[model samples]
Target: MSTDEDLDRLIEILPKSIQHIIETHQYKQSLVEIVMDLGRRPEARFLTHPEYLSAKLISWQDLDYSTKRLSKFTDDNRAGIERTLHRISCIRNRQGLVIGLTCRVGRAMYGTINGIRDLLESGKSFLILGCPGVGKTTMVREIARVLANEMEKRVVIIDTSNEIAGDSDVPHFGIGRARRMQVSRTDLQHKVMIEAVENHMPEVIIIDEIGTELESSAAKTIAERGVQLIGTAHGNSLGSLVKNPVLSDLVGGVQHVIISDEEARRRGTQKSILERKGPPVFYSALELNDRFCWIVHEHVDRSVDMLLQGLEPRFQIRRFDPESRLSISLQKVDSSSTSSKGKAMKSNKNWRKNSRTPF
Candidate 1:
């Protein structure tokens, strides 16, 4: 089915008044979220427009009409369409009464990351970093599908918020054959990561939101055991993550090292220097510039070292073409090709095309 048909399934849950208004959208496929706030006009949001879907202010009946068609809200005030990626987050008042809903449409946009297929196929653990809405979760899902269904690897997803997989017992078809391990609460992500390894015996463990020190330590444990790790961390760039003490372990935690005075002079640096303390839990990382582009650091240990030394790290610039075909450009530092880079992507051939995006 086309994306239009998928949009229909999501729109089906809205009240009749709002559904009539949404189906008229010229760019329904580009719709991002549908907003319905108590005592405010319902809206259908897209990439650029906040279009009013209904002229009338929403009432309790309107809200209930939509809620009745969906799953019950969880402790986190979130819900989703069964077996679909669309997410519905709730906004409650001080009394904990639902006041608004943000129904976010999720897509199984395949092939969006064809530009980074080489990185996915490399077999080393890699981390993706980007701001929200840049398709980190989307990319992770597609990679899980490729690894499990196509490459025949045993894969498991540590789905914390039900974003990686959909909100159902049956895993979304988008994930192919990969098994998913749902996290009951946010604080227990680290424990679940460990359990995924000890109990499941998966060849690859895909996780989302590596935010805490405990989670990063769990990631390190999994990587050390030679189980391939592919996940998203919270940082826009490698430099930001290194300074973030909680998440620094994903790129190999930083430490203060005391160098000999004589050695310091030889290196033309201060005696006290910061160095990566251990092998990075992730072999590489990619910084998403947008849905269509990313700046990649192919080597995690070397990238962290360069940042600690006050040297700008080189990057592999990747972009998707008008045809959704991926291309790679190497950004050289100091006019020398020998500078270190994020995954040194060689070419964009042999990327099997399926789905609408790499995400």
Candidate 2:
């Protein structure tokens, strides 16, 4: 189904008053979410800004009206519309009552991964990093479709919150031929990740939100077993992942080693220095600054090593326009440049399109 039709289903579950406002809004197609809080005016959030849907404050009846029409909220205080990508997360009070709702609109954006099509064909694992709502899940969804349907690879998705495959017993068509294993509980996601590999014998494993240490360890185990992985974790960039103790394992992990005085002198570094513990689970990592802009670290181990050494690592900046035109350029980071937050990216536009392999 089209995104518009899927959006209509989400609107239908809203209270009548807010629904009318959204149905008549000019920019309804770009709606991001609808925020409904108890005793406050309901709001409709778009891509750019948010607008109040009604002046009337929300009441218990209004909240109940919407909740009753949707699926039961999970242990994570989240729920979704059946067979659609839309997600609804609730905010609870101290008494365990749902006081607010964040109705996030999820769309199946095709061609979202066109910029990185070549990397997908390489069959190497990828770890995508970005802030919330930067289209991480959406990118992985399209990746699953392309790999499973087009590349004919055995793909399995670890859908923890049903955000990737939608909240349904049967997986959504957005994922194409890829199979999905729904996680019964959020904490059990790591267990399910292992289960997907052991039971399904998939060639590619796509996971969303590898947040915990156990999940990170599970990802390492899967990668060591030779299965390709495509997953997302919470962080803005690879640097953040390296600094995050819990998720550092995803990028080979970081540890402090006490080297001998002679070795430290030869290396021109402190006696106690940080170094990569082992090989990275992922072969590449992409930082999604925006839906159209991404910083690609093609070699995860090398990039992590450079960061640990306090040196700037070279990377590629890929940008895609609305026309689906991809432009690739090399970005050289200067270690001495502190004005741009200790790093500066010099774009070299001499990159050729035909030089790279096609997916």
Candidate 3:
């Protein structure tokens, strides 16, 4: 059976909340226990659902982080406090269903592995931009392994910090047959990319922390050569993502954008209390700027859009309009292109022509 199948079988034996934690996190039991204790909060049905359990863990971490920063906690208490907070964050990530535990950079997530597969099949590439600790290296390594071993695709991994391959010289990680090119601290990524393409002839190239102007340009150039590029960046969300000059250009050309649910939850908390309680809702594809990022499945797109739109303030229902919320039926969009802006109004017109958006 597949690794996913094995994970699913294990999930079947776990409690619903734990299953959610495990699936979101893909962790073993020992790790799950650490997360549960560090991040537990009281709510009647909160832990009943796995997704909510993960969210609760996130919320608790956020609360702890805020409290520690705002209050007069001692310098002596600082290390312990940070350790506690980090522990929670780590668990939250370990339990993350789509992306695994790591640091937060940009809006990137340890996306559902299947999502990466879809992007690869579409004749497009992916860049998983995030900060140092966001698990981009780990996630990308796993992705490379999955593509190479399972999907039978040739992959090259550019290990800048030795994080993806690890310190032992041999890849201590699970990524399969990934051609490793270690970038010395003084080396340039542009030069590394050139060498990988010229020598390895890989179907896809994976890199960690594409931070320079030259690295960004190289990624685009590699893509132009029909070599799929999957890498990471550091940012919080789609909005913050575009502001990053290096990542912005690479992401703009993406056909699909998969960010961590953790980032989504962070954005959700700002909206309303309800948003913080469940699965993260992706924004309308139209509002997104990435040209290659396509919502290929119309039904999934409609579902995500309807859910996200409801969570926004504009669609919120006040007491006066108990009936004010209109029910939105699922409708399919043929494209995920921003150039289709004029078509957006027309498409919405067609949507309204058929049904209303559910609030």
Candidate 4:
């Protein structure tokens, strides 16, 4: 029989359940293997009928555990099994497309894609946070691809561990048209960042796993120059990121962050900075709170630029202020706080309240 005939015969004889697995999961089993298994049963010879033969045997190594389990389902219960498989397949496909993954396994992956798109579209520096195995490196490479191909931006990747660029001794083929700077050590991260900016004239500089103090500082310098920066950090929550003085410094300026909860779960914790994007400002919540939270200003010392006293300031400090109004300067509490200062706002309840509204 032709291959198509074989497939049709198998689909017809098998219970609805097993057929469903084959259809949805794209399950393929070797005909020879099934024939061999059936040959062991002497009575199977009497069942020369193609329909009987197809129903009698099944084998596929590719199917996952659940799909494999469904293959053994009997005719009596096959309908219910098929329905279950069908539902899973639909949900998996839906999520895969939405999140940009081959299957549902790629949900976290798709988030990274969206995050990268955000960076390219918004032209902002960002961070991808995850301990490992949450597709951080893969996502970084894809970002490089999108930036280089679609946006036509000059992109450079600082591949430290070879994950982002792959291990071909040359830049991998998947990163689109970006340039690759393969570094054997992390010490070169800062130097590479600078070289990429000054020499390469890259519109976007991509790096993998920013860990050391030097690397962090270099990232800040690059961002300060107005060149877009993107990097990954190893941690679950934003708080953990702040713990590393250098990473905290580097991340302090990031405007948007995307996190992968799966990485946090794998590491027995619940945090990771999977993705970050910004215009070199707005790091974390506490950083934002300290720098620009709207609070009621019950008191203020005009002579000294400081909060006088009040029931916790109601108006948050704003990054900008009307030049004519009373000047309120908000300084970076730390290197991470975006330099959101003002000269026209002050410690006044009405002013603070009004400051929240962008003038």
Tens digit per residue, CA lDDT, model 2, 58-102: 999999999998999999999999999999999999999999999
Best by lDDT: 2
lDDT of 4 at 221: 82
Computed on alpha carbons, the lDDT of every model, listed in order, comes to 0.80, 0.87, 0.44, 0.44
| Cα lDDT of model 4 by residue, 1-359, tens digit | 23344344434433354455444432243221111121221111111221122333322222232344333322212211221111012112343311110111111112235412433677866665555434566567788888888889999988654446543355555677998885644567678778888888888898877788888778878878888887777865343453343565654422222336775555333242212232222121111222112211111112011211111222223332333222344432232221122212221223323524211
Clashes of each: 11, 0, 33, 26
Model 2's lDDT to the true fold? 0.87
**Shift in Å, residue 173, candidate 2:** 0.8
Per-residue lDDT of model 3, residues 77-179, tens digit only: 2111111112112322355321112221111123324433555665456545333443455567678777787778888888765556543355533566666
Displacement of the residue 269 alpha carbon in candidate 4, Å: 30
Order of models, best TM-score first: 2, 1, 3, 4
lDDT of 1 by residue, 1-359 (tens): 44667678789988888887778878787888999999999988788777888679988888888888888887778888887888888898999888899999888877666777787788899999988777788889999998898889999999988887889988888888999998888889999999999999999999988888899999999999999999897667776777676887788876777889998888666677667888889988999757777888898788788766656566798887778777788874442332221111111111112221111
Candidate closer to the true structure by lDDT (higher is better), 2 or 4? 2
Let me know the TM-score candidate 4 reaches against the reference structure.
Answer: 0.42
Please give each candidate's TM-score. 0.88, 0.92, 0.43, 0.42
Which residue segments of model 2 deviate by more than 4 Å? 337-359
Error of 3 at 300 (Å): 17
On lDDT, the stronger of 2 and 3 is: 2
Candidate 2 least-lDDT 10 residues: 343-352
Using TM-score as the measure, the top candidate is: 2
